[model samples]
Target: MKQEPSYIEALLPILTLVGLLTMNVFFFEDTLAGSNQVALLLAATIAGIIVRRNGQAWARTMENVVSTIGSAMPAMLILLLIGSLAGTWLLSGIVPALIYYGLDIINPRVFLITAVVVSAIVSLATGSSWSTIATIGVALLGIGKAIGINEAIVAGAIISGAYFGDKISPLSDTTNLAPAMAGTDLFTHIRYMLYTTTPSFIITLLIFLVIGLSYNFSEAVVDVANVKSAIDGAFNTSPWLFLVPLILFVIIIKKVPPIPSLMIGTLLGGVCAVLFQPHMVSEIAGNVPNYAEASYIGFMQAMFGDIIIVTPDADVNELLHTSGMAGMLDTIWLILSAMVFGGIMESGGLLTRLTQPIINWADSTGSLVASTVVTCIFFNTTASDQYISIVVPGRMFRKSYQDKRLKPEVLSRTLEDSGTMTSVLIPWNTCGATQSRVLGVGTFDYLPYAFFNLISPLMSILFAYLNLKIRRYELDEIPVEERIN
Candidate 1:
């Protein structure tokens, strides 16, 4: 049997990691580019080297790294598909149509609330916060800016809504990941999550409502009409633009696996672009005469290449570009770096070592949830990736949750609240990096406005203290083999 790691040994690696990554964040804002990932790999290597020095086989340590990353491969794959889906979906006019329609429906008087609600609806439909933000979120932010809303407030509303859908949707990896790690089924976990999630959702909507009611609707209408006309003139904007998104959502509802579903959605989008927006594709390919050839070449390149759309206006120029697969490289690099740190931690037994004190002292359920919340924040600070934030703390805290007679869903839910939602609040984390890339907003600039995230940790802690909807553990609720596993 393998021995567990000591607290001091586990903690030193994390402390070193946190100190270095914090400095990296300060020096690099959004520019550290994979330096945070490098920091993680170095920290994990240090942990692995320690175990080897103590006579643990280096091969065994390496194997643990493999297993740790192997488990997360599913999530990594999902992210890739999501990136591709965004590109092709944009090509098909699904996203543009959503933007045009969203701009139409969301009046300025209710812009903040509408922003949150619309982001939630689209992210749920597509199962992607990143996509939702990059497309419609960008459009809304621009619209909100034109309407005189606080940029931070608009960014926050966008993130809040986007994440709400991402958290609750059956398609979200974090939703699936939480359950996978906590010994629960995906649907079971999601259903259980509704308890806490619904309350948080309601509270968030109410807060946005108050903010939205304060905006001037008439001024927004004039600004919005200009944007709508501009988008319509740019592409053949029609009600048909919505069919692609609806089809994508339907495939998800039919229980199509996210990878194939997104792939199908992307292809469908490209086809839709050819049929509905031939002029747009032909213009993009610089071949106004050969529309069919232009559309095919343009769509295929768009699936695999960097394509920028230039409008007569500068702001529209920023809005009209897609890197397709190239845009996802930085995120993939960050995920890989995060996995190395996780692999080392698992191999060294450092994760277990780190969780011991918190587990040993967690006599109350409230403390247990609080501990998990703290651990998540620690990983984002130290490990510098949301993947590690979810994975490491999840593995460390699972047994503690069971031993305390609390259901695994509690752990999963708390992990999402603290891990997934708060990740963008930290500038070095992957979620932060991606959001900053997508929205053109600084992490520090929007941190205060991400009210749902800012409040979720406290809300989770409070639930723990009040014992609200915290499910009790039941041994008979699981199978014997599962118990042994």
Candidate 2:
């Protein structure tokens, strides 16, 4: 006896959520911690009330919310592992070695460009933009500050490069998830993405290069040697420490599952800490007489708790801390809250109702792609989670793309172009909150500089409008009855 809710009822929850979020942002500014989570819960409750009034059982709605949150368990586990990996890597000398080496090779004039390139390389190898930002991204931020560069610009370049790699890397969850949701394979999605991704990345790199070269170093001389010395003194900076990341890369390249790969990487980081950074581990252990016991205590603490590595240099000290798995809880909370809201909308048919108008307006291939992009962005803004943004539009548009004789890769690429990249641009989204906490940069402060993210959706639309590489399946590949003229 379930009845569909009216369009106004469907729209009310979204409007309420938006209004609350705007007020939260305006009043709290950078300190709007947990406000949006509350907003999402309130929105979900409002949606539930409307759906119940329309004859949908409250039990069924709660069931959908639980099921939706359950589906996100893998992502939650990955977030925890990433936090553990960051802690162990910092304790071990792997992260310090990277910073020490990166500082040595980079000149002030080219530092911004180098930051982008280095971040891109790391994210590509690990297939994790979050890990890249938490680790090397933090060290680069310190280095940039010491060299008199704007922190906001540094964060922008770092994010731009990290997300570029995340978009294309086979090991990325979003890359895998996008294709799975859009009815395509991972490699095919990546291959199709290159048509727009490559050009956008090249343009982004060129812009960073120009910005790097324009920096005037005479006014603010960087003391690279001093920073290196501090890092070396604080940890055992050596090339041997790189074996940890090398093993991680090898496991990823071998197509091992991400959870296992990150677990192995975390364990390797602990071993490296024990072997190469015994003194630091002992210090973290605090009063343990046995080295073996100290190593155990140190590694356990780093895996599950928080640790701060104090250095003589104040700037370097800020860069040398990790909150382990506990730090990821806030982000996990945000994701769960968002899932509840999205689940309510989905179960109530609100998302379908909201998306119908946009889908109906897609008369041509170009218009179709544009509408998909806009829908993805809209979800990112209103849904406040990247995964929801991807999943919802992807589900809504799958049949539309197939009906239009477009390939599944087109839908997948559009999801990533608008959904994945734009998530970090919004202050209330889970990606934005996690990254801002990790990199110590606000979303708005770095939004203007994330050139790759800003350009990706536009690039997708441009390719569609220009009829460039918009691959459709062979006419014979379509069913006779379903094929459109």
Candidate 3:
């Protein structure tokens, strides 16, 4: 029979993973792209060797890995659908319509503030930071550049607003994932999150306001008319395009499952593309002979592959491309690798052993919450995936919170505050990489200006330290009805 791993042995894999990830970041810089995935797999292999030597069956270890990855499949599916939705929305002119209209209200003096607000509204409506950034955020970036604002500041404002809306919106995958991981319902988690989220948002806006007022754009003239004209020349920009998103919001409000709701949204986008953008669709088809064949090919390309709508203006052309479902494969690969490592750590008791010291040190409510927050951030940095950050920390800390008689919503809120918001700030993280690619801004360039993201973790930590709004479980009653089974 194999023997159980010692605590030191349990920590070896995590330390090794961290060391490799650090080196990967240092050596590869922006090109550290898939290095984290390799590091995770290597670490998992190390973990597997240790566990196998400790009496754990190889079959059992594989089972745990499979099960862990299976649990994350829903999130993976959502990511894929999000890509499909983005592509179709771009092809359908829904995104351009938003950009066309959004540019109309840009007060150059308060352009940063406008970018933030516009990004927030779009993200909240779509329940997707990625989509918001790729679409309206891209447009905002162009507008900001045309108005002579620093690209980093524009990128920061866009990211901050998108994440804020993403954190609270029930339609958001992270919003749903955080509560699910922490053993709470969606609405409860969102409501509790507001206590910290609201202050952070307000502070972010005020800071942007001050920064906005100090800017002198008197000589810079943004040709809003040309932007609108370019969009009009490319696609059928109309209010009717918004019906697709409105229907999505209504479905989400009606409590439809996210997968189904997003599926409906994707189909709606595809239909809109076919109906309103026939000439564009035919161009995408490129000599398919039959109009019907061309439309089918074009729509399919937009839904599942790369599609670029080349506009007369180079800047507009940059904003008019989508990668569809195929674009999500890299993220999926990263997630799967992270899950393998997480599974091995969990099944072999490595995570529990590592967290035990933190648990022992967390004698008070504040310390416990702080520990949870730190763990989430650590995972985000080390594992390089936001979902893993939330899942691993939530799993590690759930019983600790229960023992402390803390409500699940508190744990859920902390996960989002630290884990969800900070992911985009890390250069090599999946969230960070994706956003940087979408917005054409490096993570470091936007990091300092992401006021809301910077403030959120601090607010959660501050609230915990002060015991502000910290809900404890009643002594005579069960703490949370939805505690993980």
Best by TM-score: 3
lDDT against the true structure, per candidate, is 0.74, 0.79, 0.81
The TM-score measured for candidate 2 stands at 0.76
Query: Deviation in angstroms for 62 in model 3?
Result: 2.5
Question: Which candidate gets the maximum lDDT versus the true structure?
Answer: 3
Instruction: Report how far residue 157 has shifted in candidate 2, in Å.
Output: 4.6
lDDT of 3 by residue, 275-340 (tens): 999988888889677988987898888889998878776666656777888877776776788779
Model 2, stretches more than 4 Å misplaced? 29-33, 108-112, 118-198, 210-223, 363-369, 376-416, 419-450, 462-485
Rank order (by TM-score, best first): 3, 1, 2
Clashes of each: 1, 0, 2
Displacement of residue 359 (Cα, Å) in model 2 is 1.8
The list of candidate 1 runs beyond 4 A from truth reads: 1-4, 29-32, 118-159, 162-195, 211-218, 283-295, 363-366, 379-388, 398-412, 423-449, 458-485
TM-scores, all candidates, are 0.79, 0.76, 0.81
In the order shown, what is each candidate's alpha-carbon RMSD? 4.5, 5.6, 4.3
With candidate 2 superimposed using the best TM-score fit, by how many Å does residue 84's alpha carbon deviate from the native?
1.3
Look at candidate 1 and tell me the lDDT of residue 360: 79
Clash list (residue pairs), candidate 1: 405-473
**Which candidate model has the greater lDDT, 1 or 3?**
3
Better of 1 and 2 by lDDT: 2
Ranked by TM-score, the better of candidates 1 and 3 is 3
